[model samples]
Target: MTATQAKPRQPDLKTSLPGPKTAEIMARDQATLSTSYMRPYPFVPDFGKGVWLTDVDGNTMLDFFAGIAVSTTGHAHPHVVQAVQRQIEKFTHVCLTDYPQEITTSLAERLVKHVERPGEKWRVFFSNSGAEAVEAAVKLARNHTGRQHIISTMGSFHGRTYGAITLTGSKTKYKRGFGPLLPAVSHVPYPNPFRPPLGSTPENCGQAVIDHIESLFVGILPADEVAAIIVEPMQGEGGYIVPPADFLPGLRALCDKHGIMLIFDEVQAGMGRTGKMFSFQHFDVQPDIITSAKGIASGMPLGALLAKESVMTWPVGSHGSTYGGNPVAAAASHATLDLLEGQVKHEGCGDSLMDNAAQVGDFILGELKGMQDEFPFIGDVRGRGLFIGIEFVKPDGSPDGALRDQASMMMFEKGLLNLDCGEAVIRISPPLILTREEAATGLDIMRGVFQELK
Candidate 1:
């Protein structure tokens, strides 16, 4: 061990999972909240600072999932807290659609710089969540192209809203019994490298998906009538499935050839999660429209749709949101960008958060890769930056979701918080502010739990 490196702190557990206070809260929550809400573990968190959360019962634990990858700057990061506080004191809401506001405009301008192409002007539409952004993009695509057919890859999760759910192909449960999904929406093959579609090689998986779409165009879905092809640059809920390097570029070419708008749903992978401002940047592909939400406001609800000026053909009053661009959320987003861009450095952060994500993600990925030989259930490890996936498989090389579920609960009991994606992948998408020592600690805990399971 390096003598200069500080030892990571350990978790403080004074009680069991769902301690007395937490159990009480859960009971009340079940009675009061929607029955649809899902909680993988019973955690009644009352406080959070940086990469740790303290529950109502005073037990403290390390957070590795960051509230399903929503807390970008970390919990209650002072810069974000202060920015939100200042914004709250100034004003909370006035609605951006009807009112011209400075903070909202400023956030939009800053985000535009990150999304716009070299010679193309760009514009933004704000919403309260990622699903709204996807909905907005769909409307814009159809409105601009005057087409009915929209294509999305299977194993994709847009959101729960009508149009977004219709585009979501990850789980039928998301669309279950919701009769009459949006019409003319088609689902095609996703280029999942780990489990390639249509018996295509990992290298050709993406092309197989492209070919499947071409076949569709010649058959039922006409190429001329397609409005947009919405897909995640790297699939999130469908597994942190990073497609082959050729996928996004190929999709771009196809979209260009057919005059179809290409939409990159970056809700879970954007805002520095993948070591880039946008996940699509890694593939060197420019989407006609980009939908973002999860990490944009650092836990505050904020979503955005960025599109080429020419493509955002819908005129004003065509779509509007009463509380889309809340000033407080805009302020929080600016603070998040500041931390992410290295405009404001938190303690122990040597560089930008994006750099931190890359470095720590690389460190963890290397450790996990090394462990694969000794741990056969560690079937595959893949991701870009911190958006990682650890696939748990049986001896027969099939996904072992049961083992994953057990390991997730075990990790929770051991005071490490992570969540599963797809059927069996545990995603280690921690807040970008996580430090090296914390990363090492998380790895230690994970290794111990995995060893126990093995």
Candidate 2:
């Protein structure tokens, strides 16, 4: 029997999770997959549908992480499944080096139209993951400007690969044993009004970042030597830090003044996860190149480096990926995009869902803020759409990862799949398709944990 058929008709939390079956599987996994990649959850997922996952022990988990923001349209979404099934029967792989597939071409054309950069044409290069997209963005910046240096902000995460890891600044553990990294990548402080680097107000933090970049160019890396400035519209693995409202436009101005490329790593924030087609759209400031991956294909492996036509000047043979634009992935992407655009007229992300996110997100934030007032451990609550974070603090207002870790572990046993990020922030990025009622259920579960801890 198929997985869905063999499973119980509805979710059941029987016999405490990691029940004999799941424990056995996890034991085997420890010897197989790298320790670094294994998750902390004890229950192993058997399959998923909609916003829920059925674990090996038959426990149903409300997936708040959304595969870390990849399953925006939800798990096993029908449109995505049908698209992939159709594509798989025809052909799965095609060499872009040999002949481009129609699926990829369609995706690229739609992306260009979606970008709508002022007075700028757009192009896209397909990739297999967010890290590859970051690599492409950096390469495009270097080749376009004939410069060597790239600038990223502290408390930012581009990806895990060499170049992307070099750009990431959240933790040194990601780079400690990796040895030498990409050359000439510089870091500046990101605008965090809550804990300002130099005591700047939130209103002025945008200009502060701009000023810092300007000083860096004059006193550190020269303008002519800089290629691009990469930033997350809303920092993801970096504590869900949302910069000042004026930050993106200010960066755009500085980049334009210095002939430096502006690259937005939207891997974690794009694809309607933030209630907009793209997070950059929220700022009305366009980047020369934007990299996306996590939610693009709703869990299928896919990424794209979108650039204004002028910046996408690499020669025909400059770059290519064997499975980058695989027909199956492209079909999944098309289906995912259609669902996002509401063309499929699906149950997810209709006007009802988007409105619900704003409504419940506000409630959750308010509740978290109340908790902050009661418990000194709750430091902050901030996010856009459903991509929210609750950062923790000590009584002295310093980061206290230990307490946060304890709270997270407590939630895990309670059957929630939340993840921690940045210094001591808890991520609550559930699938975009998650309902208002479902969010309330999960938030109440979380609130119960906070109450217990208090």
Top lDDT hit: 1
Off by over 4 Å in 2: 1-12, 352-363, 374-376
lDDT of 2 by residue, 373-404 (tens): 76768888888788788888888999888888
> Candidates' lDDT values, in order?
0.92, 0.83
lDDT assessment of candidate 2 = 0.83
Off by over 4 Å in 1: 1-6
Model 2 RMSD in Å is: 4.3
lDDT against true structure, model 1: 0.92
What TM-score, to 2 decimals, does candidate 1 have?
0.98
Q: On residues 102-140, what C-alpha lDDT tens digit does candidate 1 reach at each position?
A: 999999999999987779898999999999999999999
